[model samples]
Target chain A: QQQVKQSPQSLIVQKGGISIINCAYENTAFDYFPWYQQFPGKGPALLIAIRPDVSEKKEGRFTISFNKSAKQFSLHIMDSQPGDSATYFCAASKFNTGKLIFGQGTTLQVKP
Target chain B: EPEVTQTPSHQVTQMGQEVILRCVPISNHLYFYWYRQILGQKVEFLVSFYNNEISEKSEIFDDQFSVERPDGSNFTLKIRSTKLEDSAMYFCASIGASTDTQYFGPGTRLTVL
Candidate 1:
């Protein structure tokens, strides 16, 4: 079973537009949710993260909207730029176990 | 910001040969982890290490897989008798403390032919 599932295997957006990616999870025990950005031939870099307690968290152009009851979360990029184009992955993890369950990645391409 | 470092960005080996992937996590980080991603698939966890010992591992971390922290800064994953299916990108990560954030390094891509 894919504990974490992401939608829109690929996304295309225009520069200065909004880019959104959604994810769902089945495990209620997951307390930590994080997003990662990866480029070709590189490891994923942490972008933004949130806990279930918070409804939303924003960092500059990146934002995370979380729904504890719905068991879903999403990442939104405001005023999306060409520099922001990359593969995005949503991941969930519980404490101590150190194992992170990742969703099928969404490749976001921004056209200028 | 100090980041984790990995060696040999890519490697190719014949099937049934042993291969070792190396990583150097950020200093002061207390926990270490290993993850792998096959091309066109999601990233999967392999194992976690803490206090110089393994804390947990996944079923995919079978007998052919082993991890070790042989020195103060080096963490290694050894795969014995690698199969073509073993070809993938291996990532190494570390968290500063139990409750803190985890950081990742550029992964090593291993190709078993």
Candidate 2:
């Protein structure tokens, strides 16, 4: 079973526009939610992470808006640039499992 | 910033052959893990190692798979008699503690023919 589901297999946004990707999870036990960015021929890197205690976390132009009750979270990129074009994955994990359950992934292309 | 390092960025082997993938976690990390991703698929957990032994492993990790920390700095994954299905990009990750965020290495892509 896919515990986490992500929408928009691919997305396109103009430079300086807003880029949004949504994800929903079935496991409420998940306390940690992290988003990873991966470029071609490279490993996935941690971009931003959030805990259940916080509803939102902002890092530079990247922001993660979390909703614990809805079991949903979204990543918002303000002022999207061509450099932001890459594959994004959202993952969730609990304290005990320590194993991350990842979403299918979203390929975002920010056009300049 | 401490980062994980993996050797042989790419490996190509014939079916029924043995392959060993190596990784070196951050110097101060204690928890180690292995994960793999088939082309266009989400990363799947293979196993977790701690205290010189396996703490957890996924169902996909079968008897043909083995993990060993041969030295103080290197962790290796050995697959005996690899099959074509074994082809994937293998990633090694480590964390300072069990609850800390994991740092991933530039995965090793294995191609089995």
Interface RMSD of every predicted model, in angstroms: 1.2, 1.0
Question: B68-108 in candidate 1: lDDT tens per residue?
Answer: 99999999999998999999999999988745467888999
Instruction: Please state the error at residue B70 of candidate 2 in Å.
Output: 1.2
In candidate 1, position A90 carries an lDDT of: 96
Error of 2 at A54 (Å): 1.2
- Residue range A1-112, candidate 1, lDDT tens digits: 4389998899999999999999999989898999999998988999999988999999999999999989999999999999998999999998656578999999999999
Q: Best by DockQ, which number?
A: 1
* Runs in model 2 lying further than 4 Å from the true structure: none
